[model samples]
Target chain A: MKDNNRLLSRMFKYKECYLLVAPFYIIFSIFVIAPIAIAIFFGFTDFNMLEPPEFIGLSNYLTLFFEDDVFLVAVRNTLIFAVITGPVSYFSCLLFAWLINELPRGLRSVMTFVFYAPSMSGMLYVIWAYIFSGDMYGLLNQILMSFGFVKDPVQWLTNTETMLGCIIIVQIWMSLGTSFLAFIAGLQNVDRSLYEAGAVDGIRNRIQELVYITLPSMGPQLLFSAVMQISAAFSVSSVCMTLAGFPSTDNAALTVATHAYDFGMIRFEMGYACAVTTVLFIAMMAVNKWIQKIISKYADV
Target chain B: MKFKRSKTGPARSTAGDTAVFMILIIVGLFMLLPFVYAIIQSLKPTEEIFAYPPKFFVRNPTFDNYKTLSQLVDSLWIPFGRYFINSAVVTVVGTGANLLFSSMAAFAFAKYNFPGNKWMFSLVVAALLFSGTVTALPQYIIMSGLGLINTLYSLIIPAAATPLGLFLMKNFMVQIPDTVIEAATIDGAGILKIYYRVCMPLVKPAALTLVIFSFQGLWNSTGGSYIYEEAWKLLPTVLNDVASAGIARVGSASAASVLMMLPPCALFIFTQSRIVETMAFSGIKG
Candidate 1:
């Protein structure tokens, strides 16, 4: 009875904090959390938005893995996209941040603005459509024809061999976004005195300072950057859908998110789409956990 | 607040630095050329745009595309001003509500010792991993069930609680020394007063960062898919329809793209230096 009373009083003391934070929690629960729960529930059923959901045990998962060949292709493409783009973008952001940190303030700001421009522009990727327009008027074709390289203008988007490669190039071009900015912020936060002290403690050059002192000090931001990059790399659907047609030729640029979008929106098969996205959600969480483990190893250096 | 000062003194430039400078110049050009080309394309006459050996620079630039855009707007069944109003209302209300709610939640997490705080924070992290594609369908269902489909609430409510915005807010709040809050409390300030007067001013940089982020996001979003009514569509969706009318409207489409790109680009340019400076101080003080 005494312990219960103490607990009640403690809660009363912090009631205002609970009240202050309640609005966001309530909104998040409805919009984000509840939808996540509903999506996971739908994964176990077969529903097409017209009729009621019918529970089908594990058939949706079975169909995703065994029956659907395109689904497998999407899985493969998604993994490939994430594996290539994730690490490359991550390290390049660090590299660029390091280099930019050495410049004066005015130049640094300009360089930062330039690198971040592609992301801020609304219809930036439409230029890529013009460049690879599969005609003599296209930029690449004009250049190739001018040099007497190829007899014909190549169908870049329609050609299965080049579609995935082209998408990756554009993805990389626009990939220096949130994580890049975060890295810049993190690099700036490293204590100025630590470098001077490290130099006194036998740190010889910039390389040693980077590996030993700088990285360890920015532990929180590094972890934050890793999580952001991993999430962005896995969710490469909109860019793919916009650049190439939804499925693309021969499913070359089909990602799991795009596949799910096809099933869910276009086909109205919400259940199957739920299954596909659930798998993707799990994959992202596992990757995030792995990143945390890796980052923690370097965090204490 | 200038958190971006270089640690080491100006060192002698090396060959490696020269190589990096060259690479930056090339990369910068590659990045900005697309927008430049798009602007040039928007200004070109129809024949010039489709002309053989597609000219890199427009020979005769004109505001004919903008004139055509106004003509298209004149022909539309719905007034174009409605789209502008919808976007403006959504951006302002959504971004404002998001900043308020997120900062409030962040303060509780950062400054207050409360039950379930750790678990709640972990849930926010988990939410960060979720892709919107996963929630798109069910969210539509929920919005409709709540009768929020046609109303602007569907867009505004969802924008009010992004996990990333809250996470960043909480992180910045955590760096606000505990003694400051304690002093405020001992001075007879209530929780809300302390948050507004003491905490908010201190984290102005993070708040501005959230301002740019939330504003851009809300500005770019189209009306929810359930909102298919002609009167409810936002500017991006309207611009998309105009862009897809056919190849003949390509000039108008480019004009629309250029116009749509202006606000966010201008906002970013105006706030970017400050954002960097603000974010620089957002560093997790060890």
Candidate 2:
């Protein structure tokens, strides 16, 4: 059609721009976009690594929903993890960033480093494993015993009751990362004249100033941090695998992410794993869209 | 440099200031405790490491764990230096590729009014929703299909086009005034010259922040499922293996973590201010 021809001509006219962006799009198509397409396709098929995918016509999904008990548990655990960690971490990141923003520059940078250190350190969360080591010499166990809070070492990692809690704690501890920094930057960029105007406009306390001026100004950062936190909360895997062994005590910490890893990597059930991840992908997209809509509405207001 | 906002804004009461200081200190300590514990554990003598009712402070600090770590490295089947080299090469190359590709693409997205410009950039943003977990299985399939399995390119190439880098760079680039670019074009500068000579210098903070992010990610990456050969394993993988040996290697494990943490932390310290400055401009709103 004429529209298609015109679009093609426009593309040709801006070929240099296309050429400049080609490297990213090419790699992105291969690694990111292609994988999502393939994953969706593979979700409806039966394939292990060694075999060609056979069309299975929604059986994978049916089995995932009705037949797989572990999948249900994984979904439930993932939801709980996301619900608790997402909001808590987001608020904490905002609160901490706002507080740190008030400090003198020298002290502020040091405080930022202290909070952000745990996140940047590679595999240093393993230190948490030792702290929660379920042994007499473990830091937490020793402190509890000395204080007479518990009679004996608690199996924090191995116990189904406490495993998820330990993971959540560690996640929150490390959660003050990019989003936190974003909040700090966002706070710094808030117009100072507005604060002065608000003071003159009878904003008597810091809390009033924060609500009237700071929070509204920080809408974009709040959205960014929300998205980051939600994604991070849903994709909790490596820490779970490290602290509580894979398929933790009775799948206490078996999030959807680790479930997919279990099937795809460990059991070679690629089709089933793809189906599981497709569900996660859909859930994440829906939630992300919903949140973005809400935040953008609020921000516009 | 000085925090002038506090002086300009509503006056803080003594009680509120004290409470704020108290809460920050408590939270800061909580955030820092594990790291302090790890360093202390790493320094403790072997006997003290395993001593019942673990102490917070190391009484008899020593470097024996570090010595053991070096010895353990020396005994690895693959030379420890090979793993370090692999990690260094991956981090440097991956970060460089990411910066170059992302900045170019960002420049195009920000400055060009080409067909599919809006659509393609939105796709880049949408891709951020799909974390690595969602794509891991299919990416593995793609990697094998492309014969990237067990190769460094598998790690580097996929990482080079991350959405975060592109998002950050594009947002930064959009702030560059159009009149400046127009002036450059009028002065007989080509698009590439404008990008390189004019825009790149102006967006140095964003570029530096992108480098920090890419470097931290690549440095910490254990090559995941893509890498299998011991010779191609990164430093983290080697350190992890040592750490998982047993409780007897606890000292060295802690020592390994401390060593692993140093580079990123050091990089962060040097570039902290620039990173914050960059993030200020990264507001996602149009």
What stretches of model 2 exceed 4 Å from their correct place? A9-16, A190-205, B1-3, B8-16, B76-79, B107-113, B131-134, B171-206, B229-231, B275-286
Local accuracy by lDDT, each model: 0.81, 0.83
Q: How many backbone clashes does candidate 2 have?
A: 0
lDDT (Cα, tens digit) per residue for candidate 1, span B1-286:
5533343342223655676678888878987877788889989999999998788899999989888987888788899999989998998999999999999999988899887788898788788887778587778878988999877888999899888778777766765668889989999999999989988867665676677778877887778586788888898888878766988989988888888878877776676677556545553333
**Quality of candidate 1's docking, in CAPRI categories?**
acceptable
What is the alpha-carbon lDDT for the whole of candidate 1? 0.81
Candidate 1 ranges with C-alpha deviation above 4 Å: A1-10, A188-206, B1-20, B111-113, B174-203, B276-286
lDDT at A43, model 1: 95
Best by TM-score: 1
Give a tens-digit lDDT track for model 1, residues A131-239. Answer: 8778778887888878899889988877888887788878877878776766665565566668767867887656777888888876666777787788888878988
Candidate 2, residues A160-260, lDDT tens digits: the string is 99999999999988888878876765666565567767878898888887877888776656666776787789878899999999878899999999998
How high is the lDDT of residue B279 in model 2? 38
Kindly list the per-residue Cα lDDT of model 2 for residues B1-286, writing each as its tens digit: 3335554447577677778778999988989998898899899998998777678899989999999999998998877889999999999999999999999999999898999899998788667766565467778879999999998999999889888888777765765668888889899987788889988867665677678778898998999999998788899988989766987898898898889888888887887776554434542222
